[model samples]
Target: MYRHSATPRPYTTVVLAMSTDGKIADVARSPARFSSKSDRTHLETQIALADGVLFGASTLRAYGTTLGISNPQLLQLRQQGGVPPQPVQIVCSGSANLDPQMRFFRQQVPRWLLTTTAGATSWQKEQALGVGSFERILVADTSTGGIDWNNAFQQFFQLGVGRLAILGGGELVAALLAADLIDEFWLTVCPLILGGRTAPTPVEGEGFLSTLARSLELLSVQTIEQEVFLHYRLQRS
Candidate 1:
């Protein structure tokens, strides 16, 4: 299935860390560590408030994530608050080459797999989403280019997906920002010195926002458990 997103207020978030030296991951290929319990708890708590969770396949592969937050108490709290028992987890695979056995697939949460033309594979999407009674939600595959972003956003809106929290290791955030689709950002800057050549910063867009020198205005800045949380908005200036 082809998909695209021409959303007006897609709440794409960029959540990650930066050390005193401005490093995000380890220097020698090690998993990034979270030092602040307060930051971790706060993030998961906010995640519980989101209608769904989105991330890229590269991020999943790097972290080996299931995409479902299964904390008993937290899930219970979310359920009591009338949120979905389990949030829908969406993965953007511009190449459509996601692993079938990744925890994201094994978990009981509903999964939406997005891909591009050069990346879209029929069998993989079907097997991954279990849309036999129907079909796996096929997002636009724009690998070779040509995506229907408007339709993608309409479908998500029809699905009652108004708010979205985009968790990242990178690429997805870059794309959303490039599209000028994100409305808000919840960024976390961690205080650690896990230097890495491969691990990247929060957003990789060139110039300012992404190659065009767009500016994001800071809305709120807070520190919890030694981590810095920065809330921002797209600058009209």
Candidate 2:
């Protein structure tokens, strides 16, 4: 909804799996496998529909995600829809100090990096090593000292991205929420408790005060085994 140009931005959906205690990770910072097989299947389905999938660099480093379409049927569907066989994988970092040898860079899908001026300058010395063709999208904002997602997303729209899926590490999700850019949420709640003060949640930016919080309208809910999947539409003011 935070459109900067006359043309519309991509439809964005934040997809995450959290524990019953609302934690996406434990205190040890390990990736949580709280979701079941069905939940992962749902995520893959969504990925097939999107033109690209975005995640924070920390999330990619922590989970080692390639952001690929594993199902042959889904890959065919993507081709039929005129999108690439695999949705592009987009990673963001404030410092851009990512390990080029990581598995994420080895994937065949298109890859992009979203970063600030400082981050791009930091990576100027390294040469691309078959890291899929990369497109660096820079967002400069003096006030925030970070990315201006509204402008970044506008650039995405101009690049022919009609829909984008966000697979998160919380900070990116929070930024999109605060900027009012995400249109839907797909959350899977598992039957486990990961109680820790330092545990990561699905959203971790400057939270809105209770009175100023955005509202959500539950669109659908499904239960598969011990996991419950919830879909919601953000209700804008």
The stretch of ten residues in a row with the least summed lDDT in candidate 1 is 1-10
Candidate 1: segments with Cα more than 4 A from true spot: 1-9, 27-29, 70-77, 122-135, 146-151, 196-198, 205-211
Writing each residue's lDDT as its tens digit, candidate 1 over 1-237 gives 112333343454555656666565565534556547766666676677677677766677777664456668989987787878766677766666656655555567777765555555554555667632112456664445644555555556567666677776555666666676566677677776666566566665442533566578999999876678888876753
TM-score for predicted model 1 compared with the true structure: 0.78
Give residue 226's lDDT in candidate 2 (0 to 100). Answer: 94
Residue pair clashes in candidate 2: none
The superposed Cα distance between candidate 1 and the true structure at residue 57, in angstroms, equals: 0.9
lDDT of 2 by residue, 69-113 (tens): 889999888778777898778888878878877777667778888
Instruction: For each candidate in the order shown, give its overall lDDT on alpha carbons.
Output: 0.62, 0.81
Alpha-carbon lDDT of model 2: 0.81
Error of 1 at 50 (Å): 1.3
